[model samples]
Target: MNKVFLLSLYEEAVRVSKPKHCLPQYFNAFSKNDRVCVLGVGKAAADMAVEAHNYFGSNAYGLVVTRYGYENTESTGNIEVRLAAHPVPDENSVTGANALLAAASSVEPSESVIFLISGGGSSLACAPPSTVSLEQKLSLHKFLLRSGASIEEMNTVRKHVSVIKGGRLAAASKGQNTSLVISDVVGDDPAFIASGLTVQDTTTPQDAIAILDKYGFDNASPLRGYLANAPLLPKVKGDYKLVANAQSAIDAAVEMAKASGFSTRVISYTEKGEAQEVAKRHAQIALECKQQGKPILLFSGGELTVTLGDSKGEGGPNQEYLLALTKYLDGEPGICALAADTDGVDGSKDVAGGFIDESTLRNAKRKKIDVNAMLAEHNSFGFFESLESHIKVGPTRTNVNDFRVIYVS
Candidate 1:
C-alpha cells in the first residue's frame, strides 16, 4: 500500500504538467484566424506541438525537435518532428538547430510564432558558433555533467557557446513571438529554461567564462578565446509564459497527499546540490517526522546533480539519492521514500528512479550486497536492480525536474 501511494503521487505530479492538461488553456489568447507557426524544442516538444496542431488544425504548421525516443505518435499532420541527442549534443542536434533557425527566420511579419520550450532543449537543439567545433562543445558538456555544477551554471556556459540559444531563435523571427515554457529548472525562470530560446538573455559571456573557471575546466581551449570576443546577444520581443514547473508538480502532489489523510510538509520546491549530500539532509528531516508518531508526507522538487569524478556511475541522480538515503535511514520503521524525475528518464538511464523502505537495508544484507561499495562506485542502479526496487516509467512527455516523496508514520 505504501508503494502504491508513493507511485500515485508521482503520477499525479507528472499528469498535471503534461502538455495536454496544462497547455491548451494558454492557447485561448491566440485567435483561431491568426496564422500560427509553432517551433517546439525539448523533452516535451512533440507533445506541445501536437497540442498546438490540435488547437489550430489546418492553420498551425511548424517543426519540433525532441530527445531521441521521445516522439509522440499522435497525429500532427503538418508539424514535423525531429529527434536529436540530449545531455550531449550530436550531429542530429546541429541539424535540428539549423532547421529550427530556418523555420523561425521564415515566419512572415503577419504570422504569429509560438515556441514550445522545455527541459533538454539545451542539447536537443544545439547550434554552436563556428569558432567552437562540435567536438569541443561535446567535451565541454561531458565535463560539466561530472563537474557538480548547478543547472544554471552549466546553461550559463551553454548560452555563450551556442548560436541558436540565448534568444537567437526569437531574434531570427520576423513575426510576433510567444514562448510557452514547461520549466525544468528551479524558480521557473524562462531565461534558463531550454537556455532561453525565445527569451532575451541577461547573462554575459564573461559569466560563462567564470562558471567554467570555477569548475576547473581547461583554460587553453579555443572556446575561451571565442568567449572573450563573443558578440552581445540580441534583445528579443516576445511573450513568455511558464505553463508548468517544479512548483506545479509539487502542488499537485501536496493535494494528493492531503486527500490521502497524510500530514504533509513541502520542504522545498527548489532543491539542489550533490545527490548523496542532499539525501543525508533529507534523512534527518524524515527522522524528525518519524518522532512525531503520526502519518506524514514530505515532498520536494528541483533537479539534483551527481559529480561522477573517477567512478563511472551506472545510475542517475534519483537512484543515487535513494541509495544514499537508505543508508542514512538505517532501516527505520514506518518510513519509505521515492525519488524520480518527472520526465521519466533519470540521468542517462532509461529507469525513472528508485523506491526504498524500512526493509531495504535488511533485504540488501540478506542478499549479501555491498551497499557502501556500490555507492562509492556510483552504481546505485545496480544496487536497486539487485533488489528489484528501481522504477521504470518511460518518457512521461513532460519535465518539471525531479519529484521526491518521503512517508513517515
Candidate 2:
C-alpha cells in the first residue's frame, strides 16, 4: 500500500506537465493564415512538437531535437525529429543546432515561429563556436556534472561558449517568436531555460569565466581564452511562457495527498543542495512527523547535485538521495519516501530513482549489503538494483527536475 500510494503521487506529478495537459490553451498564439514553424529542444521536444503539429496540422513544419531514446513515435504532421546525446553533447547535437538555426533563418517575416523549450535543451541542441571543438565541450560538461555546480551556473557557462545559445537562435529568426517552456530549473527564469535560446541573454562572457574559476578551472584553461573573445549577444524579443514547472507538479501532489486523507506540508517547490545533506535534513522532518503520530505527507521539488570527486557510480541525484535517506532513516517504522527526476531518467541511468521504507535497512543487512560503503562510493543504483528496489519508468517525456515525497503514518 505504501509503494502504491507513493508511486501514485509520482504519476500524478508527471501527468500534469504532459504537453497534452498544459499546451493546447496556448494555441491562440497562431492564426489561420500564419505560416507556422515549430522548433523544439529537450527531452519533451518530440511530445511538445506533436501537440503543436496537431494544432496547426499541415501548416506547421519545422525540426525538433531530443535525447536519443525520448522521441515520440506518434505521427507528427510535418515536423522532423532528430536524436541527440544529452548531458554530454555529441556530433548529432551540433547537427541539430545547425538544422534549427537554418529553420529559424528561413522563416518569413510574416510567419510565426513557435519554440518549444524544455529542460535538457542545453545539451540536446549544443553548437560550440569554431574556436572550441566538440571534445572540449564534452570535457567541460563532464567537469561541470562532477563539480556540483547548479543548473543555472552550468548554463551560464554554456551560454557563453555556444553559438546558438544566449539568444543567438532568436537573433537569426525573421518571424515573431513565441516560446512555450517546460521548466526544470528552480525559479523557472526564461533567461536560463535552454540557455535562453529564443530569449535575450543578460549574462556576459566574464560571468562564464567566473563560474569556471569557482569550479576550480585554472586561469590557463583554453576555455578562459575562448570566453574572453566571446562576442556579445544581440538583444532579441520573444514571448516566453512557462507552461509547466516544478510548482505545478507539487501542487498536484499536494491535492492528491489531501484526497488520500493525509495532512500535507510542502517543504519547498525549489529545494536544492547536495543529495546526502538534503536527505539528512529530510530524515529529521520525517522522524518528527512520525513522532506526532498523525498521517502526514511531505513534498518537495527542485534538482539536487551530487559532487563526484573520486567515486565512479551508477546513480543519479534521486537515487543518491534515497540511499543517503535510508541510512539516516535507520529502519524507522511507519515512514516511506521516494525521490526521482520528473524526466524519468535520473543521472545517466535508465532507472528513474529509488524507494525506501522501514524495512529497507534491515533487508540490506540481511542480504549482507554494506549501505555505508555503497553510499561512500556513490553506487546507489548498484545497491538498489541488488535489492530490486529502484523505480524504472522510461522517459516520462517531460522534465520538471526532481520530485520527492515522504509519507508518515
Top model by lDDT, which number? 1
Model 1 misplaced regions, further than 4 Å: none
lDDT of each: 0.91, 0.90
Off by over 4 Å in 2: none
Q: List the residue pairs that clash in candidate 1.
A: none
Model 1 agreement with the true structure over 1-409: per-residue lDDT tens digits = 4888899999999999999999999999999777799998999999998899889987899999998889987977688999999889999999999999999999999899999999999999999898788999999999998898988998888988999989999999999999999999998878889998889889999999999898899889988899999987889998988899999888998998888776899999999999899999999999987786767888999889888888987889999999999999999998999999998988878999999999999999999987899889999989998999988999888999999999987
- Taking every candidate in turn, the Cα RMSD to the unseen true structure, in Å, is 1.0, 1.1
For residues 141-221, write the lDDT of model 2, one tens digit per residue.
989988889999999999888989989998889998899999998989888888889888788999899899898976776
Q: After superposition, how far is residue 393 of candidate 1 from its true place, in Å?
A: 0.5
In model 2, residue pairs whose N, Cα or C atoms come closer than 3 Å (at least 3 residues apart or on different chains), thus clashing, are none
**Residue 368 displacement in candidate 2 (angstroms):** 2.1
lDDT score, candidate 2, position 405: 94
Instruction: Locate the minimum summed-lDDT window of 10 residues in model 1.
Output: 288-297
